[model samples]
Target: MTAPSPACREDVRRTLAYLTAVGYGGTAMEVWQWLYRPSRAWSLEEVMVALDAQVAEAKVDVMQGRYALAGHGARMADRHERYLSSDKKMQSARWFLRVMRLIPGVRAVAVCNSLSHEMASEKSDIDLFVITRSRALWCVRFFALLPLSLLRRRPGHRTRHPICLSFFLSDASLDLRDVHLKPDDPHMAHWLLSTVPMIDDGVFADCIHANAWARELFPNAQSPRVAWYRRLACLRPLSWSLPFWLERVLEQFQLERLPSEIRTRMNGSTDVIINEHMLKFHTNDRRLEYRERFLSLARVQK
Candidate 1:
């Protein structure tokens, strides 16, 4: 077998450094797929060989089957334990999202961020990216959160499981690049490419097609895997559709509860855009902050 090149070793090193900076530790195969992009293609065996060489050179460290920077051997072990805990959390989340899909107008449910990338910590929220029908946004959210509200994980309370319905979009609003994306937004770009669809309902693929702009920034980002689709069970159809008057009533009720500033942002727009497709509860959107942090670290690394 041919020895891995200097460039290949450097790529592997940089990959580990970046991932470790974000508190994500990976196995050789995880690193391999993450490295499997359009710009710098590496075969599974090539990645494995490069990883082994890096370990030999004291450039990378592996602990409990997880790999990280040479200085983070102990942290990698802790991360591995968290990864194991995350597996059980994912199972519970899957069950919740499964029920969420059965709600009327919900088109898809996807696991996003750290969990999707397989690096979730013990306290990582179960981030879900949802797609809903064009006009049933408020109704969809009300029903979707009805059960989740009971299990809010309480502020500052500890729990191995917590569901975060942070992001949502309507079928007609799938093209988020022009609407939400900013230049050099690595977190958003990586998020688009890494979402794990638990309840596709065919809308997940459409969302991807609509967001082709991500390909320009992250040409090497991994595509959505089909294995998640095969596991979805057919949801039972809702017995009765919400009448327009009832939806309006619910929207108004919800509006009464929302902060005045957020209501001002709504500006009386209550259809799929404000009421259904655009329900974002995470006030502190961290994508920009994370992008700036990662870019600063990358520059320092160079």
Candidate 2:
């Protein structure tokens, strides 16, 4: 119950900031450079600076390691390490998206959170905002991915908004096969029609180019407004069921399209949503006991 040291607190802040900021799942030194030389370019010397007394005090949770990239430049870097630079992240994301797109069964990917690679905190897992080409495939991906390394919510946050890849594919309320248009869900069609090149089989370059344009032109576009609002409300962890049920009810018209395999998972998810609705309707005064325990006086002081 003792308070965290001031240096530890600063380290915690820096760690959170750096993980999201850099986001390449790097070794210790790579993260160090991003934090220290946040504004200016960094040399390996910046990495060494962290070894100093006060500076070292600011990296209590960071793993200790010597810099192998001491020679020079970004590519002379270690083979095994994954360092996420701003450009690198985009390139990496586009690569995966293109790969997913090319996969035979995958119709189109309705990207969500993982594309941007939200800042990862300690114990934070990756979240992929995905939409499968088909409901059978969606079910396959869901079950295939159920055991994968993933986390829904950030540690210390009560929301069950997991960091794992979650789907908003084939609206359970709509038919699965109908929504996607050869990787184009309206906007994607616009992208293919306008920005993407009709290159050889490798539409990778085309996708990258189109994605850039989409990001630039309609940067804020996500899902439709009502659906998005319901999604936002449902993932909040507590009292999630009500909005979830309402969302299902709104979307139920598409149920005829739901595949039998995906139907199983959908049923479970629907029930959870219904539970949340019931909780919201029935519980007059819901006091979450864990919130108080999770935020002790020591944590506040720290």
Candidate 3:
């Protein structure tokens, strides 16, 4: 194959460095999709050629269809095996989506963070990004958490399989800047780009459109491939009214106890914020800290 041009080589270099910084071992296809491009004009064949050149130059390693830094062959292999095992976890997320959608006003459900990027460990909770209808955010959360809480009570149940419903927003609150907490956060940009939408229902598509500013920060980033199974949650006829009344009833009697219950049961931090349009539970602000670590490593690689 002909050698890649200087620009193409730099693109490949940055892509490898970024993925390595995040401890990602990606397939050729993943590398292409995740390539740092202002425009996704590169074909898979072109990406493969560039990867081949990197492997030949000993700048990248390839093992079992996964690619990473040269000395990370074992790590690459392990990541691939974990990715193979990720199917079960993905299915768990899919099943959770099926149940979550039944809750009134739930518009979209997407898996986010590490698992969405196929780098999940055994102890990772199924982190979900839920979009609800306007004005029904808290009510929907009340309903979505009910069955999930019951499922958690089963004997020998694992926390990893349980839904971690920490982030929720109404259709009107999709900008995400309020929760971002920092300007130009690469992790947040990647999170928005990498989220795997399981249930689109037109809401996620709108959500993506509403958050198009992330593209300015992560030009190479693209929407993750939609999940194959688009089956939405089936709702009982009374599901809508149930949550409406439940939210009001809880507000009357259980409101005072709800915070403590959430803390004990969810292991959530005291920083939980509940409002009409958004719910954020990140008491430990780690986005800037984590970004600094990644930037530190990326700088060293330079």
Candidate 4:
């Protein structure tokens, strides 16, 4: 389904709603109270007020200190739903995570792609990059995510690759992050910065990724242009696959990860794999890595 423009806000809202339902035992106030980090520095009252705006129109009753997103949020998902990437997808993801938490074996869950800017209008999949604790439960989790993945795929979506990015699912031998993420290579982080939270219990933090780092690495790079040309190359007469050449061109900036976001976008627009957005942001706190790396590199280079 064509994800809506306000998918980010809507999904986040619905996700907060669902998590509020599960996270604090159906306590919307508690969910907000917890999800938003308590900063004694910021105006707590204002934060609570702004969050309350979500329930302004809904029929959710905050009895004592708990509330549900039942009335307004659910109604919007049902009535206003235009695409799977709409707030509905977020609701589905939230529900999926809620279910995961209840499952005895599951460890933690995360929601990536919540803020992805794809190249295609048609999505390839709603990537719910799940992280769990056990290596043996990999198969069990696959079976667990099977029906849900099918259910979560965007409308008109041909593929259903809800990738489980766990050390267990990938390779128990390597660090889970290493197995899921290609490497914390300077090339990758330099480009991505989009991220969101799923069920962060300090196992992971709210992280984001962007393609700006790719631009930084290839300072003279005009990837969006290159992406267009490479896309044309794939369709032109007497052409083999354009990605091979494009990958060669983008080797320095991790053509693999760099193209990931774009490819995911392409899956939306055309049938071609447009390199999946050049970045796949997992929901973790990778904020300082960028700054720290720059400083560390500057020191070494000097």
Q: Write the per-residue lDDT of candidate 1 for residues 1-302, one digit (tens) a residue.
A: 57997776766766666566566767887676555223466777887898888788887788888788777677765665666766766776766766775787778788887787667777778788887777677787788777776766422446667777756787877876644435555556667778977776677778887888776654556667635533643343333356667677877887788766665655232211354446765555666666565555545544
Among all windows of ten consecutive residues in candidate 3, which has the lowest summed lDDT? 230-239
Residue 278 miss distance in model 4 (angstroms): 21
lDDT of 4 by residue, 83-195 (tens): 33433344434445555555433433433332122211123344544433333233334445455657754333354334333211211221222212233333233222222
When summed lDDT is taken over every stretch of 10 residues in candidate 2, the lowest stretch is 277-286
Off by over 4 Å in 1: 1-3, 36-39, 150-160, 179-181, 217-241, 259-276
* Per-residue lDDT of candidate 2, residues 1-302 (tens digit): 33334443344233223232222223344344233213333333443443333234443223223221111113223222322332233333343344343433333343222223222332333334332222333332433343332432322345333234333332222222132223223223222222211112222333344345333323322322213322322221111112234344533533455445554444342221112111011111111222232233224323
Candidate 1 has which clashing residue pairs, if any? 137-276
Better of 3 and 4 by lDDT: 3
Across residues 163-277, which tens digit of lDDT does each residue of candidate 3 receive? 6777788787788766564555666767788887776666777777787877765565666765445334222122243445655665445346566645553434324556667
Models 1 onward score TM values of 0.79, 0.27, 0.79, 0.31
Rank by lDDT (best first): 1, 3, 4, 2
lDDT of each: 0.67, 0.30, 0.67, 0.33
Model 3 pairs in collision = 37-220
